[model samples]
Target: MEINDLTAAESRVWRAFHKGEPVAFGEGEAENPATGSDWGPERTVRASVLRALLLSTPQVDGEIPRLRLSGARVTGQLNLMYAVVDHPLHLRYCHFEESPDFYGSRLRQLNLRSSVLPSVSLASTRIDGPLRMTDCRVRGPVKLAGSQIAGALFMDGADITTSDPSVPVIQLHQSVLSDGFAAPGLRVRGEIRLDGATVGGSVNLEGAELSNPGGNALRAQSLEVRADIRARRLRAEGGVDLRGARIAGRLDLMRSRLSNPGGMALRASSCVIGELWLFRSEPLEGTLHLRRSRIDVLSFEPEVAPGEVLFNNLTYTALTPHEPADRRLPLLERDGDGYVPYAYEQLAAAYRHVGDEGAARRVQLAKQRRHRATLPWLGRVWGHLQDTTVGYGFRPLRAAVWLLSLLAAGSIVYALHHPRPLKAAEAPEFNPVFYTLDLLLPVISFGQEGAFAPTGGYQFLSYALILTGWILATTVIAGVSRSVTRQ
Candidate 1:
């Protein structure tokens, strides 16, 4: 390779860097200024010289000297393997003739905004300042595995593509982004990972086009974001995984088209989010699992059909598509093949919060009916009996109704029939009320039913009342227990 000598700007920066002098390069330049003289012919700063400059350069005026080379054609590997330096190297509006290697290096800030570059490695590197790569195009992969970014990592409008389609275009697994990870309109040909990442601010991947077909397009499992996770208008060919992730703010998946037909498209199991907004985005294709996840507000639009999303044990304090009792009817109409009981319970609770007890009861009834469909005939029968008698251990009033009805019938039957005495010496004391009570309470004897020995139809009524009493008592106990446990 023919190596051209450093340009006048490069030479000036080189001298100032060595002398630890504060030389302002590209200060107040156009956002993306065009180069006139420092063009065409590339300059080569060898790996050895680049390493020496990074290691020896001292801070000028109590600040790490900024080496800004804007609109310059830079050609070099710029190898930084195992290099540890606290300095800022900004190459703004530049066109790189060669890629830089920053694997296992510790850099302060690396700003290469509005530049087109080849493959670069930032694996395990510690970038103290923001790694700003806005409006750039990467022809190769950008590796950032196990790396730590102290500030924000912005790649807005950057087109990142790679030759190897199997490999991820941008990887940030186990990386710590202290500020935020924003990539608006970032078009990547492969996967983008932030698994086990800890982001302090919002993660905005709005209008990003990530294509990793039949695989994870964006895997950020167990990611901790203090602010929102806004991925509106994201066109992901594969899927976006946020399983076990904790977002303090809203997880807005508005207008995002994610396709992972067979597998999980968006998994958020055990995730604790402030609000979950899936407005205008229907989960009609793949499974969106939110099992055991807790959110304060869950705003799913009317476009979202049931059975499209699996919400097993997902607890949300509030829900939207807000209307009255019949407002959530569209969601209830879903097939919900994988719907767990807690899903209905949560919905019922949401209705209850809005003081729509009738709607809540309807949800509970529907849940019980659907649950029974999966069970055997015997279970179905038992479920039906419990539902009718005590509203599936939710309404003790139903059990009370049954108890009162049985008592009334027994009293009327005994009042008409004057029963003979069981013992001649004992008077036939049949105060129809006390006598009925004695027969009704199988465990507790009230002494009236014992004194009277009813013949004919009254004898059968006594037996019927005892059985009804036992059933009602059992139902009431179950209902009370369930209420207590729920509380």
Candidate 2:
């Protein structure tokens, strides 16, 4: 406001503000008309404003003036904190010696494209319009915690960094954005935090580099995005945490590389989302935890290794049928240590809901096979025996086949040997077929096996037949019960 403190360029802007015309900092280019050695030239202007110029700057003819700092280098610390700025601040190809403080300020619009700055801290601020900082070079951290933006926020191809790379370079904790937040090809040296943030529009972070080795590269817990949150081709060195976040649209992580072995690359526990597309050429490395999450469609066509992702209690409503579930069965095929029966069951049910019974039964059968494989040596043998004998009590007719075989062997042996009859009183009356049936049927008291008195190997043979009959009967009963219960 003081005349003595105002530089030559600031004086021109002050005059322009009084006359209500378009205003800007620095100077415009001129022809080579002045030639003087005594007076040198100044390329960029340097000035400082102590007070807020909120109402003093008038709009000429009811039209806002452009404050273009085209190819200008702004000097000194611009303290516009908590100040209501209405005009559009467009600073292009400029350099700021000190970072501006815009805390809790209501700005109409702000543009800092292709510029360099120390840092940008707009915590708890409210912006009424768009914020464009494309391809800018920010040296320090950019913090926008608890801020609200009415329009889109763009930082595409921007080079944002800090001295310490471990710290979060871009923070938007608990902020709300009316439009999309895009940052394609952004190279940030540290983590990007969007914890508890809500975006009404989509968020596109394609080809962005988020690196914070061994820690979270992007912590967006409980974030609610109304639209899609796409990060295709994202190369995250550290892990990306999205625990309990909800996305209305697709969560497409196709071709993205997230690596954090033995730890979570992306922990999305209990998140409710739409279709999840993860079809990638390279195998997804790390533990992708999706426990208790519900997704409409799961397109996991990646070549994931065992223990690479933990799908404990993950449930999906639908599965996109890109190929037959046979070839795509590898998604559920994991190592013995990482086998989850419920997860398999959930997938099977999803397949069944889509009327793909073949795929459903395949998943169920796989669950059984993998489960048996994970057991001890004795258990696997028992399972195999049950499967062959009665099909794990799923096929009761197998028991009848064993019984008939036993009967035939007994009759053949008796007919060929012509063993002594049961009483020896009526040897001719004793029928070999009747005798075999008596030994085989435990419930029927035919009086042949009881009355018969045989010695040597024949006596042992009768006892074996009785034991075999009893075992077969028990197996049949079990098989019936199992079949009914499954139905």
CA lDDT for candidate 1: 0.76
Return the TM-score for each candidate structure. 0.74, 0.80
lDDT of 2 at 467: 83
Instruction: Show where candidate 2 strays beyond 4 Å.
Output: 2-5, 11-61, 305-307, 320-339, 369-384, 390-487
Indicate the TM-score of model 2.
0.80
lDDT of 2 at 429: 60
Model 1 segments beyond 4 Å from truth? Answer: 1-66, 82-87, 248-250, 270-275, 292-305, 308-380, 400-462, 485-487
Residue-level lDDT of model 2, residues 262-379, one tens digit each, is: 6777788789899777777246567777888989888766454335556777888876644576765575675223787887778777776877766766666567677888889998
Which prediction has the highest TM-score against the true structure?
2
Q: In the order shown, what is each candidate's alpha-carbon RMSD? A: 5.5, 5.6
Q: After superposition, how far is residue 50 of candidate 2 from its true place, in Å?
A: 9.7
- Candidate 2: RMSD over Cα atoms? 5.6
